[model samples]
Target chain A: MIGATRHYEIDIDKVDHMSKQLTEEEKSQIYDDIKEFLSEELDVPADQITPQSKIIDDLNGDSMIYLELVEMFKKRFDVNVEVRLIGQYFQRHPIYTVGETAQAVYDIVERGDNLLADEDKASV
Target chain B: MDQGIELVELSALTAPGVEIALIDIERHPHLEDAADQFLEPDERARFVTLRSPHRRREWLAARVCAKLLAARKGLIAGPHEARIAQDRSGRPALVDPAGRAVTGITDCSLSHKGRFACACLGRPPIARVGIDIETVSPRLRSLRDAFVNPSDAMEFHVDTDADLALLWSLKEAYSKAIGAGLHIGLKNITSNRNPATNSLRVRTLAGRVAHARHVVYSNCVVAVCFIAQ
Candidate 1:
């Protein structure tokens, strides 16, 4: 039920991405949040989770859990990017592991409303 | 076979061309009691890989439901002969020992509630099938905004938590039938209720219509939905 509110308008100009990138501290924070979220949701130990741990094979995760993570970031960062576009991006370039998903969340937050822009393709 | 065939008549819960079977996990024997009776070696191997004990129970219950139905329908030599494997998209299928999808079973869906799990199957010409079970409680009432929209239902009158739970199950079933689950966004799968019969005319934004039959069994809302190819 998280990320229930899908309809939101983010003025791309007012996003104020602070030069449109994530700082090192911000990256670490994102990783920490992911660790906590997956640990709590999947009921796995936080220590066992790694950036390279596969969500499905390693952490016993399904797509719905990943969708919850997306909704959590949407509310926490207030970056209401298009979830459908991200879903399509996921289809084209799937993120399998913990670190890849963290990087995707960072991109989703940093890119804000332009997550689907041609130039903003997720590296993973 | 007794478990599945007997429950098919539990309710009039039926779609046009699909068959469904329910498993009351609370009443069924434990996995430790009879896992080998149903689960194949490879199936047991996959089961051992699941870490969470709660998830393992649900997974075993769902597979039992699917396998019982498949065995009763003569789709397999027995329960252990087929495996209900989920693809990367998270859509489950009835597959043979060699890892290929089985014939006469175009789609197979598994859903689990607190103590109940249901499996549904449909053949070719029917593109997909999905089944879901959810308890009707205050929890569903609190998450109104998550599943329902202003444009979703006009005169449907979602005046009770049970009604809202039905809506949520309908959406979940349709999402599974389409192989997207909640990844496609909850709002994308919409429905208009047939207030008289309580059946739903569910549709997606892509204009795909699925027929769903809903029934309330032992405080759980169950839905089975399917679409034509």
Candidate 2:
């Protein structure tokens, strides 16, 4: 059932940019980890996780899971993504699939430090 | 009153036939142990797999509260005699000792927030019922646009965090009552306030209407919904 539902198109440009920062092997490994995590968290079969599966509609997940996923990305990638920024991003662009979530995690890992610093400065 | 739903305290709803149980998750230091006594084998397995302590506590509290309510309603001999299972849409249903769906015989809904869990039970003919409790917080304001319907946003004026929390809880209660949850988006559920009675008339996009009653306790807003008979 994975990759069965397609609502939004993947940003190939962003994917290409992410590819430069992380190796193809690393990306595949990250995707595998995400699929495993979600499968276990949602109690769904791993085979059902597709790049196009709707996180809420298909996976039976909620906003809290999205926030947790962002935190997981930060810890797994050793980056500093602001929780508030990730929350706002999810609100604006509700993630639907494993692929979209992976892309969002990759983008955050690539620019997390700068974003966290900017958020800190803005607070001051 | 909107649809004749009288707002009352959780305690007030407790009567001979109707059973309501409220559990303070924080007060029970050994809720995990108590919860185990109530959960069936399948429920226990699921409970073991919960990664978050908070989630586990809430799950346990809700199940325990449900079991207590079921016992009080005489649907089961004890907590272990009943099993709570979710349908395809993830709505919890009561299974009798004979392993038959008892939802037709009894109606139950569970809601929890922070350290509080509430379970409300009604007999047959009250097939659809929902209860939700949410802590009053500023976060409700930020998530308002995502859930509050435009019609409700304009008709039901929310001036403070408490008001927003009540509105969100009302929507959640209604959704759970309909057994659709958020599948029926919060924005799809409309609310019309009856200030004179301090209640609201809520309608779902699916054309189901329910009367919601709420009360505030310990910084939390609790709402319950029942389909008009």
Interface C-alpha RMSD after superposing true interface residues, each candidate, one decimal: 4.1, 11.5
Candidate 1, residues B86-123, lDDT tens digits: the string is 78776788898888888788888988766677888887
* Superposition TM-score, candidate 1 onto the true structure: 0.78
For candidate 1, write residues A4-88 as lDDT tens digits.
3433244556667533566787778779888888888677899999998878667767555676687677676666665566776
By summed lDDT, the worst window of 10 consecutive residues in model 2 chain A runs over A1-10
Name the regions of candidate 1 deviating beyond 4 angstroms. A1-14, A17-19, A38-64, A93-100, A119-124, B1-10, B98-103, B135-147, B153-164, B181-183, B195-197
Binned by DockQ into CAPRI classes (incorrect, acceptable, medium, high), candidate 1 is: incorrect
Model 1 chain B: weakest 10-residue lDDT segment is B1-10
Give model 1's DockQ, 2 decimals.
0.19
Error of 2 at B125 (Å): 3.3
Clashes in model 1: which pairs? none
Model 2 residue runs over 4 Å out of place are A1-124, B1-9, B12-18, B195-198
